[model samples]
Structures are given as structure tokens and as C-alpha cells.
Target chain A: MTQPLTAGVSLKPQHYADALACRAEGLWFEAHPENYMAAGGPRLAWLDAIARDKPISLHGVGLSLAADEAPDEDHLAALKRLVDRYQPALVSEHLAWSMRRGVYAPDLLPFPRTQAALARIADNVDRMQEVLGRRVLIENPSLYLPLEGHDLGEVAFLAALSRRTGCGLLVDVNNVFVSAHNLGFSAEAYLDALPAEAVGEIHLAGHAPDANADLLIDTHGAPVAEAVWRLYGRLIARIGQRPTLIERDDDIPAFQDLMAERERAHALLTRETVDA
Target chain B: MPDGFHDRFLAAVGGDEAALAPWCAGPAASAGLAVYRNTTAKGAADALAAQFPTVERVVGPAWLAAAAVAHAADHPPRTASLLTYGEAFGGWLTTFPPAADMPFLADLARLDWLWTGAHLAADAPPLEATALARLTPESFARYRLVLHPATRFAGFDDGAPSLWQALQPPGDPPADLELGDAPEGLVFVRPGLDIDHRVIGAGTLAFLAGCGAGESLAAAAMDALAAEPGLDLSTVFAGLVAAGAFTELRTLS
Candidate 1:
């Protein structure tokens, strides 16, 4: 089996065989646990075979930690099954809620960082940890519209969640760039202010410029921007090194292209570790 | 905090133009919220469309996308992970206005949903021929074969199954494939990381349905033959076994 992932790529069904045959060092894969949440089938079988040969991470997009309540029990149970089966090196979910009143909107939605919201999310995270029998990494989401009723900054809220639920942070530098630009904040300062020691992983993905508005959308469809790459370097320099991922969700290039991006991250992490 | 953050965030996401004006300044606010809303809805629709490609192909991407979006808005995913989302979409389409003309659309949607289920099913070993060889005719009468975890079959009152089969590889002009005016049957199973499917007849459907409902093998076969004489029982049984349908066997009390 491969070592715990140092640099990884999101596993797509279209590239399943390529992912299985890939030979990059310390190369790993991450998948949305929801995709494998089924009774019996080829998707689960493929994941089983891949997990036997590599370190996998279950990157969840649907736990809805920021929702008004805890995750659906069935969803949590399904997640637990994947974790148990794969023995993934990392398990992560976003700090956004997409399900409420039994209605799910398939995105990492934003919410005000109020004390109430923080407490509720922290409780939700705690429940997740308790059920999964392990700690998880909570990711920061890309924000579009800012709302009122805030009592904490994104970094501060993440730090509070880490402290309360023993969860770590998966900092998506691209999200920081996108949200910072849209909401008018310094992406550099946002990254710098993050509790670097609590950060367990990093995400780098592409974004698109909104046609109708002066905003950047986190489309994850293109190459990582130079600005985000530069910020990633700076974050790695400060935090030493973490398991970084190069995410390409849509208009996916070939596996080799993603591996090239992953190699860049691996090189950066290697340099930072050696320097440290 | 002017009001509850969750409530305000919901208001902002639901397109309350001014409630989030402070959060989103100026003319860009509505556009920005619309972007989020569109992305969220599109993400759900895209996953559904991918899961149900044959249905999308039948309905056309543009028309299906619109239907998927409206279907999603009413019965949004219950979990943040969209992999297992859209359980209600097939049923929802039966009542959708635009889909009314395509009355068989619901069955097609159900087939797509089953395909998704088969694709994501757990791994299981196919029943070995040796295991079957060990069974005597008397034992077979007492034994009920358990279907694989990934096995799914349906009996349709019309030709929807045949149309779906035509969409499979090696079949030509699935679009031109006519839905015959007779009840059809289908069976889907994944043997080794690939989903395999087949179109069967009335006897086979009755047999599988009887097996699914916990009937013993002999009883199911009797039921199948009763439904349609000359069903080539041995051949059909062997075909199902080869397709990785049965995973276990149990003796009925």
C-alpha cells in the first residue's frame, strides 16, 4: 500500500483505470464518499481495489456541517462504512450547509459566522467525529454574497471549530482567493492569519470569472491561477508542509495533466520539509 | 446581529434582494446570489443527468436539464454529497407537466435510477457453477437462490425496457427503436466492476420476481413456466447464473 498521501488528485470515474495504473510517488486519490455510498456495485468494487494499493481520502461535499442540525444519520452511517472499508488517510468535509428541512442544494453554501452558527457547526462537527471514530478536516468554502449577523472571521471560526471538536482545517487557498476578491479582503492576509499549525491539508483549484458580475466563481475547471499558486507557496513556507491536493472537478484534463499539477505540489512540499 | 444568521443566510440564498444588501453591496448583489443559486441548482442537475444518461438522451439535454432543475428545486438532495441524491426525481417526473406527453418517461427514469443503484452496489462473488452442481432436484425445490447485492430487475407494462436496451452498446439507432406494445422485463447486475444488463421475457421476469419475493427455486420456476410456456428454463437459468445474479442459496422452511 502507498504511504499516507503527500499530494493527491480527486478520483473521477472517467479516469478510474488511469488512476489505478498511475505510478507517481506518494501519489494518492480522494473521492466524495457520497459517490461510494451504495449497497453493492462496481463503484465500490473499484474503490476497494484502489484503496488496497494507495492511500485514499474521503473528501465529503455533503455533510452539511453548517446546517441548522447534525448530519442525516443514514448519511453518517454510509460515511462510516467508507472510512472503515478504505481506512482513508484523511476524512474531510466543508464548513457549509446544503441540506435543510430535507431539501439538499448541491453546493457548499455560505452562512454568517455568528456565535450561534459557530456553536451549532461545532456541535455538528463533534457529532461527525464521534460517529466516524476519528478526527476530520473542515474546509473553508468559496463565498459569493456576504450576509449580516457575523461574530467571527472565517479563520477564527475554523480555529474555534478545531479547538471545540478536535477537527483540523483543510484550507482551500483558491477559495480564499475567490472569496477574498469577491468580498473585498486581502487573500494574503487571510492565508497568513490562518492557524498554520492546525492546517492539515491544502486545496488548489481553478476559478472562472463571472460573466454578469465583477466576481470570480470557484469553478474548479481550469488551471490553478498564478495568484493562488503564489499564495500556496507562501502558506507552505509558513506552515512547513501538508498533504496538498490539486482539484479539477469539471472539464477535466487527462490524468497526466492532473498528475503534473500534483507533482508541483509534491515538489513544493518536499522542498518545505527539507528546509524545515 | 440584526437577526438570526441562519435565517438571514437563507433569505440571501432564496433571493431576498435587500436583506443581504449590506453583505453584497450594489448592483452585483443580485447577480452574485443568482450565480450561487445557479451553481447549486446546476450541480444537482448535472449529477442527476449523469446518473440518468439514457433518460437525458431520450429527453434531450436541454429539456432534461430544465426538468432536472425543476425536479431538484422541489425535492432537493437530503445530503450534501450528491452521489446518492435525486431519489424522488423518477416519481416526480410522472407528475411534471412538460413530461406529460412522454407518459413512459417515469419508467425510463426508474430504469436510470436502478442503473445508478447497480453502478454503486457492493461487491459480491457470483454463485459458482460448482455450488449449483451440488444441488439435487429435490434440494433445488427446497432451496431459494439469493440475488446479488447489486442485482436489480423490473417488469414494465410497455416497451420502455426494450428502448433502454437499444441504448446499450452494440445496438443501433436506440432512438428509432420502437417500444413494442407488450410488457417487457429487465435485469441489471455488476459482476466485476462493470454493470451488465439483459432484456428478458415474461417467464423470466416472473421467475426473478418470484425469487425476489423469497420463493424457492422450483416454485419460482413453476411460476415462470406457468406465466409463459416454453421459456427454455435450463437456458434462462444458466444465463442468469452466468450474469452473476445469484450470490447465495438458502433452504426454505
Candidate 2:
């Protein structure tokens, strides 16, 4: 197996050749495991070629950890097969639900953080870790609405789940910034309240201002904003240097554009490690 | 514990504006549920839409998206990974009231489903052309062939495959690419990770279906010729091997 990631970009098909050819120091690639979940295709082939060169991270967007039930067995089995085949350095899923009954919603859907919800999510995470046979990093989901129920705050809930299931955290700083802005909370407090030791990775991505609301949307469509870069720096300062990624899922810019953003993250991560 | 979080959440996601009113207090709160609902529906619809793009292109995004949402509601994903989510959508659209007029939509969905199946199938080695050439004519007659792990095919009553292909970039078809009556069959095989597809005629379809049923080459070819008389037996037999359709050859004693 490869070593842990240093700096990475979400591997996009358009940027496959560039990702393969680039020799940026400690740079790697991450992909949505769901996208490559095929029987056979060029997507898998490209990933194989890339994995041969750089460490890969299987970031799952569709694994609904907060669902009212255990993670789907077949889905876990499929993911385990990918883990076995690729032997990716890291595996992670979100702290949200996108599926229920038998239909799947592709977006990460939010749920009220309650003790019952925590127990259920922990069970799901346990199932995932059990199947994949490794510790997974559960990301803090971006909240869009502030609802009425909660047994624990988001940070506390994540902390409890990590303690119970032995999973670590994949803190997306941009999600923190976006959710904090949307739901009326301090992003710094949310990041600070997290159990620092539980964090294995951090994500820095761009967001778009919701045309309708005053809130900023976690749309990985644009370049990382200056505020998010500042937030990422603060996070690296507090959490120490973890594997940080620059995520751009939609309206993906040129490979160089992403590399430039990644370069910024790498510089910050490098400085934090040196300073620490 | 809040009294109706689950019920209200579901109602809000289902697009009932009033369901989220109790909890959402401010002016923009009504829009909050709308975002969640839109995001949820779009997620499911988009997954369906990606899987069934031909259907979407054939039926337009707005119409197919609405139908996809309904299909998702009936068969909400049982798993978190939505990669293989819409196995029931093709069948669901057949009975869908809006799609009742377009019988071909179901067939198009069937092709999409098979495409997905082929895409996700296990990897397998393709039978080499040299291996088939080594067989004696008589031996070839008795040989049973196994297809590649990712092999998938379906025969439609009309020219859906041609229409599907025509819709590919270079063709750039218009809204309705007039469905014709040429019976067509599609075969998707992944020798490695690349899913290659081709449109075959009645004879090849019959032969493939026979081989799929574990029939020997002679028997399968006979079945193919029977389906479409005067079918060039040599061309049909050679075509299968050339396409990397079958992955293994064996003599059934």
C-alpha cells in the first residue's frame, strides 16, 4: 500500500492525462468511489494507471452514514472490493444520507443530529469499517437548514462517532465555512471544537453564494475563495499538517488552475509542518 | 425529541411547502426546504438521468427528470452508493402514465440498464482470435463459448440501437430521430476496462442468444440462420470471434 496523501486534487476525467504526467512533489489524486463503481470501463483503466504512479483516495459521496439504518451491505461489499483491488491509502465517506428505502438521492442530504441518529450513524460507520477492514474518515457535512432536534452538536456528534467506531475525521474546511455562514455559527469554533487527534485529512474547496439566499453554497464549482484559503490556513495551524485536498467537482478549470490552487494548499501544509 | 422530525423531513423533501413551516422560522426558511427538496430530487433525478441519458435525450430533460423523481420515490435507493441505483427505472417507466404514449422509452431504458450492467461487470479475458482459428471445422461445430464477464446484449423490435448511436456526438440528432422498423441487437463487452459496443442484426443476435444459452457453435449458428434465413454462417461465426464477444471456448461432451 502507498503512504498517506500529502496534497491532492479530485481526479477528473478531463484532467486524467495531466494527473498522470504531472510530477508535483507529494501530489496525489482523489475520486468519488461511486463514479468508478463500474464492472469495466475506461474510468477504471485510467484510475489504475494513475494509482500506479500516485497514492489514491476513495472519497465516497453516496454512502449515507446518517440514514436511519445500517449502511447497505451490497454497497459496502462493492466498496470493499474496490479497497481490495486498489488498496487506496485512505477511504472516506460523508456524515450525511443520500439514500433511503430503495431510491438514491445523489446529493448529500442532512439529518438532525440526535443521540438516536448518532447511534444509527455509528452503527453504519461500524459496518463500513468492518467491511473495508480499515479505519475510514467521516467528513463533516455542510448543513443547509437549521432544524429543531439535536442530542449533540455537529462537532460533538462527530467526536462521539469517532470514539465509538474508531473512524477519523475528514474535515472539509469549506463545508465548515459554508454551513457556519448558513446556519449562524462560528466556523472557527466548529473547527476548534473538533477533537484534533481524530482528524486524518482536511478538504479545501470553493463555494458559490446562493442566488436566492444570503448563504454561501458549498458548490465546488469555482476557485477556492480567499476566505476559504484563510480558513484552511487556520485549520492547518490548529490540526497540524494532514492530507489536504482541493476539490472541484463542477465547472472544473484547467489542470494548471487546479494545480495552482493545490500549490497554495501545499505551501500552507508545508509551512505548517515546518513550523510545527 | 421533536414530535415530527422524520415525517416533516420527508414532507419537506417531497416538496410540501407547509411541512417545514413549524421549524423554519425566518423569511428565507421556506426557501430552505425548497433547496433541500430540490437538491434531493435533483440528486435522485440526476443519477437516473446519467444512467438513462438516451432516455433523457429522447424524452427531453424536464420530462425525464420528473419521471425519474417519481421512479426514485417508488424505488428509493437501498444503498448509499447510487452507482447502480436505477435497476427498476426501465420497468417503472413502462407503466408510467406520462410515458405510456412512448413505448420505445421502456426499450431505451432497457438498453441503458444493460449498458450499466456491462459497465459494472467483473473483468474477464477475451478469447483470442488465434484460438478460434486453431479449431478444426468439425471441432468448431461442437465448441461451446462463454462470453466475457462484462458482456450484455438486448434485441429490440425496432432500430433503437441505430437511433442510440446516431444520438452520439458526431450524429447530433434532432429531438425525434424517427424510430424505424429494423430489428436491432446491441452487444456491450469490456475486454479490460473499456466497454465497447456494436449493433448486430437478427442472425448475430440469434447466434449470441444461443451461445448465451450454452449451445454449441453448430447449434447456435443453426438457430441464427433459422431466425434469419440465408444468413452468412461464415461471416456470422467469424464476427463473434472478431468482436471479442466470447471469452472462452470449450467442447461439451
Taking all chains together, each candidate's TM-score versus the true structure is: 0.93, 0.90
Docking class of 2: medium
- Model 2: lDDT of residue B157: 90
In terms of lDDT, the poorest run of 10 residues in model 1 chain A is: A1-10
Off by over 4 Å in 2: A1-4, B2-4, B16-29, B56-63, B91-106, B174-176
lDDT of each: 0.84, 0.82
Scored by lDDT, model 1 comes in at: 0.84
Native contacts recovered, each model: 0.77, 0.65
lDDT, candidate 1, at B243: 90
**RMSD in angstroms between candidate 2 and the native structure over all alpha carbons:** 2.8
How much DockQ does model 2 earn?
Answer: 0.50
Report the number of clashing residue pairs per model. Answer: 8, 14
Docking class of 1: medium
- Provide the lDDT at A187 for model 2: 92
